[model samples]
Target: MSVDVRWLGHSTVTVDVRTPGGSLRVVTDPVLRPGLAHLRRRPATPDPAAWAGCDLALVSHLHHDHLDLPSLRRMRPTVLVTPPGSSDWVRWRLRRPATHVVEVAVGQTRELPTPCGPVQVTALPAHHAGHRTGSGFSRAPRGAEAVEHLLRVPGAFPGRDLDDLLLWAIGDTGEFAGSDAVLAAAGRAPDVALVPVGGWGHTLGPHHLDPRQAAELVARVRPGVSVPVHWGTLHPVALGATMGDRFVEPGRRFVREASRLGVAGAVQLPVGGSLSV
Candidate 1:
């Protein structure tokens, strides 16, 4: 099996998992918005169509960046996998029903039969939160519902939602309830593991994973190769720093510590570059 992992800055990654016949590509949290809040836009823009041929799309959680409906709709993958409570959001944003989105709660594993073969995906526990809130809202009770309905209008959802929904992940700061569970439910190891190592602030959160925490997870999950993400994409709201500076270091940190910790197979790929593993 060969896996091509591309780092489109931050947590967005395009994993092209290959078998003997063809390839099964999996995209993780792709963002294409610019000048969001404090963080500046990525210097380069990655074409979503590059992933147009992907077999499956993985929305880790409901942060705008991860579950951006606009970017999601543009890809048009055969299958969509996300955490619980995400179906409504994805379906609503994509102007589709919940049935179109595959709901995978933490610790749930599903086998997607792709042209290459069976692509196994396990929904692991992430320390994150998802909410749909825009600046404008009236006092009416159903105002939120009305906005949701508009998003759900057929063909109204575009690839732009990926940026509108600012997905915020609280890093691994506190005791995790499902950290061990994610490792356990995975059963056997995966060919490629995409882990987050940056956050919205300088100080990491209990739910989010810093470089060190990501390294530890890498050791635990023991994937063939680990790609660190969730950094360098968006600027920290609190710190007022660029996404590139904040996230670039942690990936290097993960490499050094993982190597020092004797955890092998730690590699970093350039944004828009490809890796065969």
Candidate 2:
């Protein structure tokens, strides 16, 4: 069996796995539209229609860029998987039926049947904080009230911290007992792991991975092939020149760090580029 991994800019990746039974395609964190708020998509905007046949769509978190409603509508995946406590928001925003949405928490697994076989998806824990955008209060509070609120509240005002899932896709598998079985089998490493190494900013935020961190993940996951996504796609519109530099530099940094960490088979793919393994 072989799988074709395509980087469609940002965290959007389409993995086409071929098995004796048939073929299945899985996409992650698709943001197809251009010029989202203060950010503008760099050159080579991905075609929304190219993702038409996606059997499964995996959303890592609820950030606007990662879980864009407009982009999700364009893909219209058969099944959408998100972290726990996010199904309600997705359903409400997408206006899709509740049945189409599936929420998987950390250490949980969801199996999807395809013509080739059953593709087992295991949700692993990620380091980043997965908070929803605009989950805070509408108006800014002043002085002592703000201090008291900050002291009392655990998280942001509205949205709670989400389960930042590092999705592991296992292809050509027959049946699994449960999440535990899947984890044990995953000890052998996945054929392809879609790891997010960077984001749309110059500096990565909390719960996100920089080049060094992503390299460490490569060593830990030990997949047959590692493709670094979520970089060089989107940047702040106001930061001229810096945006262009960020778009191409982070991938190179990840590659260098992976090599330094003695991780083999780390492939830094360009937007719309693909590699088969």
lDDT of each: 0.55, 0.62
Q: Report the Cα lDDT for residue 87, model 2.
A: 72
- The TM-scores of all predictions, comma-separated, are 0.75, 0.79
Of candidate 2, the 10-residue stretch with the lowest lDDT total is: 144-153
* C-alpha RMSD for every candidate: 9.8, 11.6
- Expressed as tens digits, the lDDT of each residue in 72-185 for candidate 2 is 887877778776666766777787563277766666656665445555555654544465546563121111000000001011112324211123532111111231232353
Which candidate ranks first by TM-score, i.e. highest? 2
Off by over 4 Å in 1: 35-39, 96-99, 132-178, 236-244
**Per-residue alpha-carbon lDDT of candidate 1 for residues 1-277, written as tens digits (9 for 90 to 100):** 4445677766667766544555566666656555443555544667765576756666655555555666666667677776565565466557644224776654455556666655555554444444434413311111111000000011111343321111112212223554545334434454456666766556676656777877876676566676766666565455544334664687788888788778887886666666765
Residue 179 C-alpha lDDT in model 2? 19
